[model samples]
Target: MSNKKMSGFTIVELLVVLSVIALLLSIITPRYFGKIKEGQEVVLKQNLATIRHAIDQYYSDQGMYPTNLNSLKEKRYLRDIPEDPIMKNQEWQIIKAPNEVGVYDVKSRSNEISSNNNMYSEW
Candidate 1:
C-alpha cells in the first residue's frame, strides 16, 4: 500500500483568499456607489435643462409659460416631464420668476449634497 498527499487548498489558503476578496470589495464598493450617485446628479441637471428649454419653447410659441409641466406634454413641447434622477421621481422644484404666475425655471428637489458640496436643491 502506497500513501500519498492529496493536492488541495488548505483551510488557511481559503481564508486568505476570502479575506483578499473582502478587502477588495471594501475598497471598491464606496467608490462604485459614489460614481453612480454622481452620474445620477448629472442626469438630474440634464433633465432640469431639458425641462427649462421646453418651458422656454412653450413661451416662445404660446406667449406664456405652461400652467404646469403636464401642459408642456399636452402641447408636445416635451414628450414627458424628465424624471428627477436624484429624487427618482418626476417631482421638481418649479420656480416662477419673482411674482410670475407660471413656472419660469426648474430645480432638483434632492436634499442630498452633490460631490461639489452644493445641495441638489440649489442646482
Candidate 2:
C-alpha cells in the first residue's frame, strides 16, 4: 500500500468541525442580541436625559417650558429633538407644564418592558 496519508479532512472530521462552529455560534448569538438590546436601552436613557436637560434649560431661559419640542430646536436649546431609540420615532410623550401652556416632563411612548420590569414609559 502507499505510505502517503490522506491529504484533506475526512467526512467525519469535517462534520465535527462544522458541529463545533455551530456550537460556538449557538452560544454567542443570544449574548450578541442581548448586548444590542442593552445598548439600545442605554441610548434611550441618554437621549431622554439630553431632552430633559434641554427642556430644563429652555424653561430656565424662557421662564416657561417649551410650547412644543420644535421650539427647543428653533430657539437652539437642542439641535434636534432626540429620537426615541426604543420606539424608533421622534414622537415623545410630552408632559404638559403645570402652567398648562408648555411641555414639562417627557416619557417614552413605547410599551416595551425594560430590564427592570417596568414599562419603558414608566422609566
Candidate 3:
C-alpha cells in the first residue's frame, strides 16, 4: 500500500485553532467596545452643538432665549427635543431662569457616562 497523509485536521488541531480564535476575540473585544463608547461620545457632542445652535437661532429670531425647553417646540424651532441617544430617551434637563428672564439652559437629564467617564449631561 502507498503511504498517504490525511488532509483533514485532527481533533487536537481543531481544538488548537478554536482556542486561538477565542484568544484573538478576547484581545479584540475590549478595543471594539472602547470604539463604540467613543462613537457615542462624538454623537453626544454633535447633538449638544445642534441644540445649542438651535437655541441661539431661536434667541436671534425671538429676541431672547426660550423660557423653557417646551417653548422651543412650541415655536417650531425644533420638531421635538432630540432624544439623547446615550441617555435612552430621558428628558433633557432644562435650567430656566428662576427670575423669569426667559433664558434657559438645556442638558441631558440622564447621567449617562461618556467614553471619558464624563456625564452626558455635563457635555
Local accuracy of candidate 2 as per-residue lDDT tens digits, 24-113 = 999999999989889989999999899899999988888888889999999999998898989899999988977479989899999999
TM-score of each: 0.92, 0.92, 0.79
Query: What is the per-residue lDDT of model 1 for residues 21-118, given as tens digits with 9 covering 90 to 100?
Result: 99999999999998999899878878888999999998899888778899999989999899998888999998886666788888888888889998
Measured on C-alpha atoms, candidate 1 has an lDDT of 0.88
Q: Which portions of model 2 miss their true places by more than 4 Å?
A: 1-6
- Among all candidates shown, the one with the greatest TM-score: 2
Q: What clash pairs does model 1 have?
A: none
lDDT of 3 by residue, 1-123 (tens): 569866888999999999999999999999999888788777767777777778888878987778776787888887877777677673777766566576466777767666667777786
Task: For each of the candidates, give the backbone clash count.
Answer: 0, 0, 0
Task: Summing lDDT over every window of 10 consecutive residues in candidate 3, give the lowest-scoring window.
Answer: 96-105
Predictions in order: lDDT? 0.88, 0.91, 0.77
lDDT of 2 at 13: 100
Q: Let me know the TM-score candidate 3 reaches against the reference structure.
A: 0.79
